[model samples]
Structures are given as C-alpha cells and as structure tokens.
Target: MRATTTPALFTRPRNVAASVAAAALALTLVPGSASAQQADTEPVDVRLKVADAAPVEVATTPQAWPGELLEAYGVSVDGNDLVDVVRDGDEVSGERKRLRQGDVVRLTDVVKERKTKRERVRRGTVEVFTTELKPGVRKVVREGRPGTRVVVARKTFHNGEPVKYRVIKRKLVKDPRPRRVLVGREAYAVAGANGLNWGALANCESGGNPDAVNPAGYYGLYQFDLGTWRSVGGSGLPTSASAGEQTYRAKLLYKQRGRSPWPTCGRLL
Candidate 1:
C-alpha cells in the first residue's frame, strides 16, 4: 500500500463575503471618503425668529424646506402669518426656500381688529338778510353747535405694531346746528338825501320819537305807514325798529317820492 500522505489542503472560510463587506464599510468611513464627506455636509445651523420673541439657534439639514424645519422645532404658523428669509440683515425671499447655513427665518403675526370711535362735525353759518340795521352790518342771532359721528374702522397689525387702517362705516349721531346771523341790506348812503336835514324832517314828522304812533296807522320817527314802510324795505312794525332804521327808511322814501309820502311833514327838510 502506498503510504501516500496527502498534503494539508487550505480552504477559504465561508464568511468571506461578510469580511469583504466590513472592509468596504471601513474604507467609506475613513477621512476624505465619499460617505464621510456626505456626513459633513449635513446638520446646518440657522437662526429662527418668531414674532417679537428672541432669536434661537436651530439645526437642520442642507436643502431642507423651511416649513419642515419649523415643524421639527415644534413651531406653528397661521394662514395670515407672514414667513420670510433674511440674510445680512435684509429679507431675501419667500419662506418656501431651502435651508442654508447662517440664514434667518422670520415669522410675523398678522392681526386685524375692528374699532369704533366718535368724532365731531363742524357747524356751518347761515345768513338772514334784514333791513333793521345799515348795509354791510351783521349780527349773530344764533350760535352754532357741533355734531357727533360714529366711525367704524378696521385696523391691521403686524407683530403687535400697527400697519394699516381703513374706515369701514360712518353714522351720524347728531346733526350740526347752523349759526344764524342777521345781515343788513339797506344802502349806506341814500342819493339826494345826504345834504338834506334828516333831524328837521324827523322832528317835524314825529317830534324825533322813534316809538311815535298815529291814529291813522302811522308809526316811528318818520310816521311811516305799514304799506310805505315795506315799500322802503322796512321789516316788521316801523315803531319796533331803531331810530336810525326809521330815519334810513325815510331817506329811501324821500329818494323815491321826494317827501310826498309825508304830506303833513313835507317841506321840513
């Protein structure tokens, strides 16, 4: 029998595939490897500001949406709230942009409030023409009173600061009272009567008595009848008018009828 001793056969382990995979993973984790470089690019640090609150530092991955980042930080947003990106102390763009290192995300709270207030309405002046005084003379008969109005407005605010205001409705609470004034319409100077002796005529007509009255329905210093008084632009009873007013109407009458209206008191001037 051949004492043939077979040489010892060396066989590879069945775990060769596992060992190769482990070696490949180790190479990828080494410095400057593709996996190591990819890890370094993640976990970006950014600043987040919400309304008037203080800014906070947050960590996120590159190219991550700002909405997702906010969700991760447990922040909420409303439909009216404003979101924006800031860089170098200036706004960059909308909030839908991806996250970047050293970027700031700002959230502004928008609010609208309805307000009601009362305001004053200024009064106006009204003029009433009369012949009680000389022309160009004015007298206040009634004082004016201001009115009130209710105003309803919508005020908009951003982060507790007022931004816009608009008036939505207005209602008059009280009507304004107009000021009433009496203005004179008699001419300052009556033609052809300036050189005449008005005092003599008045004394001869009613003895210079402004309140004089006659049984023939004549009254005042000029003894004017109601028909003649109104023809000379006189208002109310001539006896109720002032002495100067009575004289003015008499002068106007003289300019028209040449003292013919005062038949008994004629030729006194």
Candidate 2:
C-alpha cells in the first residue's frame, strides 16, 4: 500500500513542439527586446586620422602641376582624372586633407630634360679688293668672290615622354614648343675644366654656342663629340652658357690637359 506503482506517461512530439512555440511567442511578446536587438546590430561610423597627423588645411582653388604625378599616383576623383598633384603654397597647409575611399599615396621627383645645341652655317658671295697680276703681273683687281662663312647660332631643343600609366588612358596632347635657354654661360660654369681657356677652346670648337651641334653629333659650346664629351666629364656640365662661362670652362680643360690638352688652342690656354 505504501509503495504504489507510478505510471510513466510519454509526451507526444507535437506537445513538445507546442511548448517550444509558446516559449518563442513569449520572447516575441517581450517589450523593447526587438528594438534592443536592432540597436545591437546597427553599424557605427568612425573617424580616422591619416598618418597620426592633425587635420590639414585645404585650398578652395585648384592648382596646376606636371602630368608625371598623375602617372605615379594613378588617382581619380568623382569622374575626372587628375593631371597633377598641385598644392598652392599660400592656399594649402600641412593640415590639409581630403576624403578618399581606396588606396592613396603621395610621390615626388625632379624631372630633367635633354638639351641639344645646333648651329647653321650659310654661304654667300662678297666683293673683295686684291692685288693680282694677270699673267703679266701688272694689274690690281676688285672681284666678287664666293665665300663660305660659319656664323655660329644656337637653338635649344627638348622632348618629353608621356607619363606611364596602368589604370587610366587619358592624356593631354600638346605641341611642344622648343624653349630657348641661354646655357652657354651656365654650361661653362659646371664644365669646371679651364676657366677662360676652356671658353676659348669652346669658341674654337663650337663657337661658344651652347646649342652648337657638330655634324658628328658633337654638342655644346665645347665641340664635344658624344664620346669625347662624356669622356672629359661632360656628363655633369650644363648644356648652355655665356661668353664668360665658356671662357671659364675652356681654362679648366686647359689645366686638365695641362697646356697641351687642346693642341690647337693650348697656347691660348
């Protein structure tokens, strides 16, 4: 009588499912739970400083720069491509910056151009007075004689390569105008060869014309052949000069060649 048999009742699978459904329904019925979940799922926006630097000051106007910068950065904004990264000294500040989404970087370099000097000579006829004996040695005559004269003149030439780009294919095509630079003076300075004698030698070689290019492709006031020019350390010399500069280099070369570097003008040196 004290140990009565207890009946074990089996719960139907449908009844278990109903309990779980009731629990889910109770959770949905909780106040502000759905709103709390939404708040937890929302994304947050954050501000990040670049290079750990303070904010930079930016200019209201745009500036101009070389196209090479565009090639290095390969950058674009909105729908327009950048030709250069020009910052106005007065308008831009170290604190200046812009909003960007993709990979961005800054690069800088100094560009140099090859300079060539050329001279053109002209032939003309002129009247000359001379004493000449016509077989009998009895007559002085004035005659028009043909003569070839070399008037060394200078013209500067420059050529530039297009900026290399991999991302975009847009560029500004321009007709390059040769800029005339008086390099004869400065070229002689860097020539660092013979002071005034170098100038004299150059005058003899290239007529003190910075743009004087010989038929053999020799260039500069110092009638330097491509090989010889490079041999005598012409690699570092400026491509132009004035009379004073030409003389300066000429003297330096004279010292290097030691009174006989230039057989033709060594004495002058």
Q: How close is every model to the real structure, measured as TM-score?
A: 0.49, 0.23
Instruction: Supply every candidate's count of residue pairs whose N, Cα or C atoms clash at under 3 angstroms.
Output: 0, 34
Top-lDDT candidate index: 1
Q: What is the C-alpha lDDT of each candidate?
A: 0.71, 0.34
Indicate the worst ten consecutive residues by lDDT in candidate 2: 1-10
User: How close is each model in CA RMSD to the real structure?
Assistant: 22.7, 27.8
